[model samples]
Target: MPTSKDLCNKEACDIQSCLKKNGFIPERCRKVIEALERCCEKCSYNSKHCGSMSRLLGRKDEL
Candidate 1:
């Protein structure tokens, strides 16, 4: 079975695209944001790229 980190690798770009289309409005992309948060939390301590998702996004509560 694929892990959260694996899923994250596949869907990370969705967030980027959504942000670009919505003028970086996170509230407008709640679903995508939540999905990425789940992945980031799963990979927090294990994946270097995902370790700082909360810090990088400035929404620590979500992660």
Candidate 2:
């Protein structure tokens, strides 16, 4: 059987690229980050990229 396509990869990459363009400032990448979060939520946080949510949100302590 063919494997399923991975989800949220583009959104995750967008966040990384946005951060790089903005000197690693999270505020500048808010929109992209939200996009990724939405994708993760839609997938029930099952995407591999979803594991970085807490870190991306700067709430690693809660994780």
Highest-scoring model, lDDT? 2
- lDDT, candidate 1, 1-63, per-residue tens: 766445575446777788799997767777776777677666663544364345534573553
How would you encode candidate 2's per-residue C-alpha lDDT over 1-63 as one tens digit per residue?
311236888888898899899998787778888888788888788777878655885542232
Off by over 4 Å in 1: 1-7, 56-63
The local lDDT score (0 to 100) that residue 52 gets in candidate 2 is 65
**lDDT minimum window of 10 residues, candidate 1:** 47-56
lDDT of 1 at 52: 36
- What are the lDDT figures for the candidates, one per model? 0.62, 0.74
Report lDDT (Cα) of residue 32, candidate 1. 71
Residue 28 lDDT, candidate 2, scale 0-100:
72
Q: What TM-score would candidate 2 get against the native? A: 0.78
How big is the positional error of residue 44 in model 1, measured in Å on the Cα after superposition? 4.8
Collision pairs in model 2: none
